[model samples]
Target chain A: MSLRQILLVLKREYITRIRSKAFILATLLIPLGMVVFFGIVVGISLWDSDTEQTIGIADRTEVLYPRLQEIASERYQNLSDLAEDSLQALVQGEEIDGFIVLEETHIEGQKDPEYISSGSGGLKLQNTLRTDLREVIRNERLARADVSEDVQKIYESDITLTTTKLTESGEETEDDTGFLTIVGFIMGAIIFGAISGYGGLITRSVIEEKTNRIIEVIASSVKPIELLFGKLAGIGALALTQMTFWIASLLGFAAAAGPLAGIFLSEQMSNMPETAQTAQAPQGIDPEMFSIPAIETSLIIYFAIFFILGYLIYASIFAAIGSAVDSEADTQQYVLPVMVPIFVAYIIMFQTMNNPDGTLSVIGSLIPFCTPIVMITRIAITDVPFWQISLSILLMIGTFLGTMWLSAKIYSVGILSYGKSTNWKELMKWVRQG
Target chain B: MAVIEVKNISKSFGDTRAVDNVSFEIPKGRIFGLLGPNGAGKTTAIRIINHILIADSGTVTINGYPVSSKTQSMIGYMPEERGLYKKMRVGEQLIYLAQLKGLSYEESKKKIRYWLDRFEAAAWFDKKVGELSKGMSQKIQFIATIAHNPDIYIFDEPFSGLDPINSEMLKEIVIELRDNGNTILFSTHRMEQVEQMCDDICLFNNGKAVLNGKLREIKQRYGKNTINIEFEGDDAFLDELQDVRINNRSANYAEIRVLNGQSMQEILKKAMNHAEIYKFERVEPSLTEIFISTVGEDNINPKELS
Candidate 1:
């Protein structure tokens, strides 16, 4: 009830948390480690040479020999002239990635023939040889009857498909849409990770206090609500600190890695479909989109609303669990129920990635339990309706208040308890006692 | 005037009535001891006083004001659980807790420094509480509890974890605080502590007070008709002496409990006729013996009368 008292508690919480090795490591090292990890992954994916792997040619049919010669001269220039014995030896040693022995299979009543590869890894080679051999054979037959390469080009161009997604704000963004869909999955994953990390920290803190029985001294000096709120606020600040540092470092790294990503992306896009190529083009980096101030403000607002609500929703329940049980060992049993909803939210978010405007996505975003994660994704990709956003916020606030009321009842009853395991019936009685 | 007064305080946890009609009054500037064995509801009673747990039925008043948020500022409580934020430095933790008890930063710092120095723990100012011994933590907690200089203090087993030397030091400070006009309600299972530190005592058994009065009065009222004699005499002569039961005998002396209506002079006369009387004195029963006799034998539920 006293502002000075609450501030004193808050100061203690901050001082203690900041001095800990765990908080320091989480705040600083995690972001750097993540950047290094992702950087390595990206680097490996980009620089790996798939083109250097050699495939052995085994054209026993001799029907496809000329076509194999042409492919070897063009796509595969590093081919060595070796006998079948050497080729089989190379295949067994895996010195060659694979070997393609084109065997002509005579199928009764079939218009053409079938070619098979010696190993599964040579399937691509087999396909290429078969198509080329078919063309050469067709040309030979067609010269007797006349067909041209122009007709083949026209046939291949007819089957390409393109798609588009209109953002809720009505701007056409990412016509390919698959990469944009990953946005929801990423948002859900981030939310899950952040909440679990901070919530576990809060639970650990409560367990520490409980095991130490320091709650007694604290309860004497401050109200339960004051203690609970101060704890949530203090650790919540730590979580935000870590999150901010991570975001800032990531943005900085992305900025620095921009040219590298652009060059690689451009090269990659050249091999991709036209839709993917346009999506990757460097367009000013949209300086506004990268503005720390704007993103920071939005994040602050987002966390301010969701963090308090989400944290209290989790923390109050966690505190209740801390009090209800006598030890940390007992806490593991209660964790699953708390975790399931968040897990469900994540699964639902994954499904919504492709159709952000789908019925399931719309409903999931509206639900308070999933709204903190899903709505953030919605906001990141598209402008959400003010009314819908307001409704979700109100729902979260309402749920938080409701949870607090319930958790306080549990805390009041559970804090002094010992030597016995708490069960559902007893918890129900505690809740109803209010 | 009563510094703290509780009337008909009863609390039940589910089906168990932990505290039943426990009423007691603590007058100003005196040490009031709340003595009880384990599971006798001493903790529940203290928690109710602190407003940490509301009594199912009772009225509690501190300095004529009902127990409320405003009244809490005038009260200092040290729970038996020995709570301290272990990760925090001793000085920082004390200062923070003192501030919470309504002291300003300057007042808290000054008081904390004084107490830390008094306890000879000034060297451990920057040491984390978890690094401190149990005695040192207790010292810090004692300072924190009283830093705001509350009119009423409830110290539940404050000396439980302390060594004899630290216990003596704490007892001295407690007496000094009492002299300085602080009303303290002390609770412990150690009856010797109660005898030494308490002005008045209340003994609870089964959520009810079996014995309650000034320590002097209780000891006197519970006194046995006995004489302790140490004489330069033969043990056989003392053993044959009439109208005396030798409770204990050592090399040159014997402690005799004279029967009711037997005069101490008569016992001395018998002793003198036998041998030279080196020492002869009538004795009051010790508080420890009185407490044990009172609670240990009485199966009758100390009536939970309001």
Candidate 2:
């Protein structure tokens, strides 16, 4: 097998696929779509947070009116002694977001205070109301008991726990489990999508050549193994190009998201401060989460390695399947067997995310078929043992070589043998003959 | 000197022996024809010669070098199932194929232009192969086959999809290539094409060469034992003929193979008694007849032979 010939085939495969509209659309559209989708989601959440609600309170108890007035800020409207019918009219007219009825029995602590709204209030609003009412009630009780203000202030102080993870060397690191899980999930998805998508490209390319009978002209010139390698390398390059675009776009979005979010928040605040303050603070995903992870270099490098090896192995299998069949429809039987391992790996991905260092994750990471996705997740979540990473890499390369050998053997025979569908027995026969 | 020499090559797939003990020689600067019916292993033999399939046993050498990738580069092969990249422009596909045959990009580009012009397909340079008519693609495929200007060419069923006009055009180009000192070997079930073109012929049946030799010598060996006659009112005399196998019989014409040392005069005497003989002549059997006679009655399909 001449390297020059292989390179020629590779050039053809690469140029044709790269120039295809489908490749261009997919490489650009998928990442753009993901960015647009996330942007809308975040924008909606922020917009919801800026919409402040006006809560009208009907304080039935004359004793509670002063406390309610003191606790109510710009967001609250104290409608003391307002009749129930008028309050209902206000709620119906959309004048007040909701009304709170503080009955006289509230002093006896016999019934819960009622808060009504057309829609459910934001969590932040609910928390703020609960805290203020509790504080006001506590102060009233404290005054009756003749407690000192200093004691009450001490009692009202808030405490928060500072969490840290100790490393193997006893260095305290910020607990980044949530952050790591998110990163691992994103990385795993990228690897999976790249492998299956590019691998499918290899399959369809092979089937196209086979059906068109171009394989005859090609097989006459280059060795079948060379053709297989050329296809794998070509499509692999295309996949890498697409992945680079996606990574760049993702990083670009992450970098710009902070300022973009700030601009959005400031605009909303200026437009409607009352709603903005009362709205629930955006939940969970901070803009800082999009910042480059701590192990970004190593993660990116390992992801590249795993992705290349994974693509080689799977694409080889797909090429072999393509050769053995005449058309895409005939691929169903063979495709399932090849895809089962990948499906298994995908199913184990969630478990790997939860416990990256668990025995299941360790085993999955070592397995050649699952290693690309599972091991990347493991690396993202925790510091995997150096030996484990090395072994996984070694096994991936070794497995790819074996698969290439097997696939080339089958492809050499299957490409020329047309008309009849090939079975496992015939494939095995070809392998043995080779 | 023989440019392609096959020595007892055999290949089998599973329980079926696709090619068995096949041996032939294609001398340089000559057109060789490989002929057989469907499933007759002609394709298998050609593939083995191209190094697309390895022989189970025996050897194949091209210009004294064993059939390897190096030798393959010196050969041009257009398979029975002709194909080109459907989405690629005709010129680009030709250049790509030419390059695959070991031509440099510049060399391929130059040759591609020459061949496209030769086939009168210069206007189709930028047309995708899928957009071309079947006959047009055949021309492009032919050009691709010979664009690298290899020493030897092998085309299987090259004229299968061509119109009669395009077929004659390709035939002329093939002959022109031979005159230019390129050794050509083509496989076809079209007997008339082979008879008109081939200097040497290897007839295959059931994975073996049933007949092999120079075309003239093979025909000469059959001798002038057949008669071609065009006559009118031959309503009953043919039934009176003995030891003769009649073929292509019509109301005004009949081809008769005289066997058992039968005399042409006896057939003539009987024919004149029933009808006026417009023409009668004893002639050597055509390649179609020789093919049928050699492959035997049991194996021959009259429709395929015709």
Candidate 3:
């Protein structure tokens, strides 16, 4: 195999593919579009949570009215003067979000207070209303028992558990498992998408060359293995180019997302009441937890290693399938089997992310076909054994090299053959002959 | 000295022998036509010569170099099933194909322009191959085949889809290539084109070379037993003639082959007795008749061969 010829073929494949509109759209526009789409979703959800609901109260007891008003403040409206029919009309007209109907039971807790609305209200609103009502009832009971407000304040004080991890050196570090899980899921999904996308590209290109009959001319000029290697290398470079773009964009987005989220949250804070502002403070994992440290160098390096090997394995199979048949329609027979491993990996991705140490996850991570995706998730969610990672990487490299050799043999013979569809038996025969 | 030499080259695809002990040598600076019925292994032989396929047993050499990638780079091959990338521009495709043949980028570009201009296709440089008519694409394929200036050129069924004008244009270019000391070999079922263009010919039948040699020698060996007659009326005398086979019989003309010690003078006399003979002459057996007679009737049906 001539290096010059291989380089020429590689140059052609890379330049032509990268210049295509589809590659450009997929590599750049799709990611940007996804970010915009997610931003819209997040912004809309924030808007939904920030808007406070106004509740009208019709209390027959007259005792609970002031207490409810004090608890809800500006969000509560007194409707005790309205008749039953008028209250119904107001509810139907949506004059308020919903109205609370309080009935008298001689100040004894005989029945639960009903909060009516057109539909279920937001979880936060329901929780706030329930807690306030429970508190008011408890305080009433507490007064009967002559308990002081200071004791009540002590009972109502919030407690937050700061979970930390103790390292082997006797130092405690903040547990970032939640953040790492999210990072792992994202990385796994990206690797899976890149491999499948680039693998399909290799298949389509091979089919194009075969159907065009240019394969013969090319095969004559260079060794078949050189052609296959050149094609893989060229498209592999394109895949890496797209991956680099995605990673850079992600890092850029990560850097900008903090400030952007700050501005967006501040805007929402200024638009809401002070009480609502406190209720809507960012919850769960801190934004800082999703930092660069979450993506360690080892994970990135292994991710790259597995991604390339995975692509080569699948793309070689795809190319062989491409050569065996005359058209895309004929690809069905071979494509399904090749896709099984990828689909299995994808189906188990979430499982691996959730329980990286589970039996299924461990096995899936070690399997050559699933390692690229599942192993990356495992690495992120938990500390994988070094031997496991190395063994998986080595196995993937071996599998890919073997697959490439076999595919090249099939491809060399298959490209020259036309008209009839070739089956696995024929391909095996070619491999044996080679 | 021969530019390409095939010695007992044989290739088999599974149980079917595509080329059976096929041996032929194309001398330097001559047009060699590989004539055969469909599926008679003409393509397989050409592929082997071009090093697209390896012979199971035997050897093929180009310029005394054993058939390999290196020798392949020196030979221009246009397959019978012609193809070009439809999405690529004409000039770009040519340059790419030329570069693959080992030409440098600048050299490919220069040759591409020269060939495209020679074919009067300068305006089509930027046009996509798919957008061009079939004839136009064929021209591009032809140019791509020769643009690298290889010393040996092989074309399998080169004129299958060409019109008369384009075919003529290609015939001139092929002749010019041979004149420039490039050895040319082409396979075709079109005997007339082979007769007109070829200096020597190999007639393949059933995976074997049934007959082959210089065209003049083969025709001389067959002898001039055929006669060409052009007449206006009374073509019934053609039926009365004994020991003669009539071919391409028309109302005004007929090609008659005499056998069993028959005389052309007697046929001419009989034709003059009934009709006004415009022309009467004895001619050598045509490549078509020679091919038919050599391969025999049973092997001539292309549809059945496949």
DockQ of 2: 0.77
Residue A370 accuracy (lDDT) in model 1: 81
Off by over 4 Å in 1: A43-55, A60-145, A156-179, A259-304, A378-388, A418-425, A432-434, B226-282, B292-306
Q: Pick the candidate with the highest lDDT.
A: 2
| Ten contiguous residues with the weakest lDDT in model 3 chain A | A282-291
Cα error of candidate 1 at position A326, Å: 3.1
DockQ of 3: 0.70
Task: Rank the candidate models, highest DockQ first.
Answer: 2, 3, 1
lDDT of 1 by residue, A56-91 (tens): 555555545565566554333233466667777776
Please give the TM-score for the first chain of candidate 3: 0.78
- Model 2 reaches what TM-score against the true structure? 0.83
Residue A58 lDDT (model 3)? 82
Runs in model 2 lying further than 4 Å from the true structure? A39-162, A165-175, A257-295, B234-240, B301-304
For model 2, state the Cα shift of residue A115 in Å.
Answer: 15
For candidate 3, what is the lDDT?
0.84
What are the per-residue Cα lDDT tens digits for candidate 3 across B14-107? 8899899988888999999998778889999988888888899999989999998889889998888888888888988899889998888999
Which lDDT tens digits does candidate 1 get at residues B225-247? 66677878565676666765564
Residues A295-333, model 3: lDDT tens digits: 568778877887888888888888888888888888888
Structure candidate 1, residue pairs in collision: A142-A146
Please state what fraction of the native interface contacts candidate 1 reproduces: 0.76
Error of 3 at B151 (Å): 1.3
lDDT score for residue A314 of model 1: 76
Provide C-alpha RMSD values for all models, in order: 6.5, 6.3, 5.4
